[model samples]
Target: MSTFGVIARREIRLALRNRGVVITALIFAVWFPVISALGIAAGAGGDAAAVAGAIATIILPVGVFMGYLFCADAFLREKRDGTIETLLCAPVSLRRLWEGKVAGVAVPAYLTTLLSAAVTIAAVSTLSGTPVAAEPLLFLHLAAVVPVWIAAAAGLIGAAQLALGMRENQILGFVFIFGLIFLIAGLQGVVSGISPVTEAVLAAVGLALLALARFIAGKVTKERIVRTIP
Candidate 1:
């Protein structure tokens, strides 16, 4: 396997072994979708548009939150324990390392978000006594835009964790989490009627942010990270 794949697989293995984090992530992933679906079903009477909108609105935040959960300690833990130094001496470039870590966190996060979506659809159908499904655009949103956003989030958060002190990371982590929560909450009404144009625009924005995060991650140096270690 390539270095990137090896690193990514390692991180995935570590993430899965953290039973506390995994269980917490699973609860959030399942709870939000179920609650949102129940509310939408009660109000919209199993309307496909409403169900789709609820799926679109809830899944993005759930996926991003999962990324945050998995990546919260990915870089920081390594740096704190002095493992990052050894890894840094390896032949792999910093950008590839960042990509690998981001991919590692993003894969499971995206899958959990898919589970959230499925629960949403199932809940809506069960409650409404009809087979309701998401629109294709929403599926496109899930398949394409959601993963990109998760990757961007993981990359940015991992960069922050690597570059900042523990205190700064804690403060900034709270800000990032709350900021994202509020932003998604504010967008709930707007995304409910989301169109193809909106999905395209979101995909473009996610890609741009992912690119920007990659550039930022590439700029993070070993010296800077070592200095930030507590």
Candidate 2:
């Protein structure tokens, strides 16, 4: 097996051994759908599309939140347990090490989200009494999009925890990340005059910032690093 695969196995194994994490994830997997069903029943005024959109909004955020929890633990617990130093001393590139940790943590979180989403969709169909036909292509789209979003969120959180060793830094990192999310969401609501080119430019800039965060974390794991200029 490749170095990344080995590290990924170890990380996943450690995560699986944690009963609290498993139980919490299971609870989320079950409750999210039930809540969605209740929401659908309470507010289904015959608009299937609106119901679907609302369901997506609620479920996607929950997924992202779960991804954050999965990663928050993964990033910090390994180092806390003294395994990270051993892992880092191994014959593996920093990039591959980071990649493995990301994959190991992200896979389960994404899977949990997918399962929760499926359950929620089914519940919506049942409670709304609407014959919901899920287009295969739409399902495929969701399957692709959900993971990417989760991975992106996980990457942000992992990079934050890695770069910022202090608890205050982690809190600030989360504040900034969520602040950026809301900022972008707000911009989307008010960007009638913004050109597509500008939007693309902004996205590219954001991605570059993430890349820089990764780079800095790999270089200096001791001090907290935060970007002042976007």
Candidate 3:
């Protein structure tokens, strides 16, 4: 019954009403994992669990994409539909509304990802020949942190959409593309040493840029509105 929870539920209900959104999201969450696992299992003809690890790579990009997609829709949709003004008229603070929107999408998308992972595991076990050694402990670690990463990525996109409006083409597109670059960079560093702090700092920098973009967008939008009202 908390404000965040209420707002989250409300947003979720809205998303649910859109069959396309729900179904498409479910496809992203499930398809890649299942297909990758099945392919590796069948090709290698080895342990089913081992094939699941290969599918984890698919989760990484999908997670980033989902995060951005969710956040973008959350904020941008409100603005497009004039719901933002109505929400602002309510008791919800700007920050709280933002937080609620993040949760609204992240929670459901993440749960779908989890279910997809389960399905992948089962299918791989039956269909794959690769050794499947997915440790329960490792899964726990991923589950705990992946959501945070997704939230961060989504928040950046939401902020961009809010602040940049029609001008967001370059900025939002760059950030979205940057996620892929970051992943590639990380892969390149696989053989080299990487500090935990460095990783955290990089993530912090991305979030900071997102916050700055949002602030700038707000100012620009407000100025444009004021100018038009002559």
Candidate 4:
């Protein structure tokens, strides 16, 4: 395997072994979608528009939040345990290592979001006694755009964790968690307003942000990382 793959697999193994974090993230991913589906069934009888809207408003944020949850294990916990120092000494570029860690966290988070989406549709269909289907654009959003958004979010958080001190990471974690809460609250108003054009625009922006995160992560030097180590 390539160094990147090796690093990513290692992180994946570690993430799975962290049953507490994994279970908590999975529960969050599953619970929200089912609750949202219940609301959609009651309000809109699980119509396609309602289904699409719920998927749009809920899936992206949930996926990103999963990234946030996993990133603590991928970056911050490793740093705290002093394992990151060993990785830093390995024959891998900083950027590659960062990318690997992001991928490790993002893959599982994205899969969990997929599970959320599936449970959401199933719940809506069951509650409404009618088959609910997502719009094609919304399907694309879930399959393609959502993963990119998750990766972008993970990359940014992981990079920040690598570059900042523990106190700063704690603050960032609080800000990130609360920001997602506020984002979810704010999106409730737009559940029925999401359009394909909006999804496409968000996808484009996610790509840009991911690239920007890569650039920022690449700038984190060994000296800086070592200095930040407690």
Better of 1 and 3 by lDDT: 1
Q: Model 3 RMSD to the real structure?
A: 4.9
Give the candidate number with the greatest lDDT: 1
Residues 1-230 of candidate 3 have per-residue lDDT tens digits of 99999988987777667677677878876777666765767664473333444545445456666666555566667666666666667786556666677678777667666666666666666675433434542264246435655666665565555555545534665666476548635752552222344334445554554465445444444343222221
Decoy 1 TM-score against native: 0.93
Compose the digit string of candidate 1's lDDT tens values, residues 126-163: 88765556368778888898898888778878878877
Worst 10 residues of 3 by lDDT: 221-230
Residue pairs clashing, model 1: none
In candidate 1, how many Å is residue 22 off?
A: 0.6
lDDT of 2 at 7: 76
The lDDT, on a scale of 0 to 1, for candidate 2 is 0.63
Which pairs clash inside model 4?
none
For every model shown, the clashing-pair count is: 0, 0, 11, 0
lDDT of each: 0.80, 0.63, 0.58, 0.79
lDDT minimum window of 10 residues, candidate 4: 184-193
Candidates 1 and 3: which is better by TM-score?
Answer: 1
Q: Per TM-score, what order, best first?
A: 1, 4, 2, 3
Error of 4 at 113 (Å): 0.9
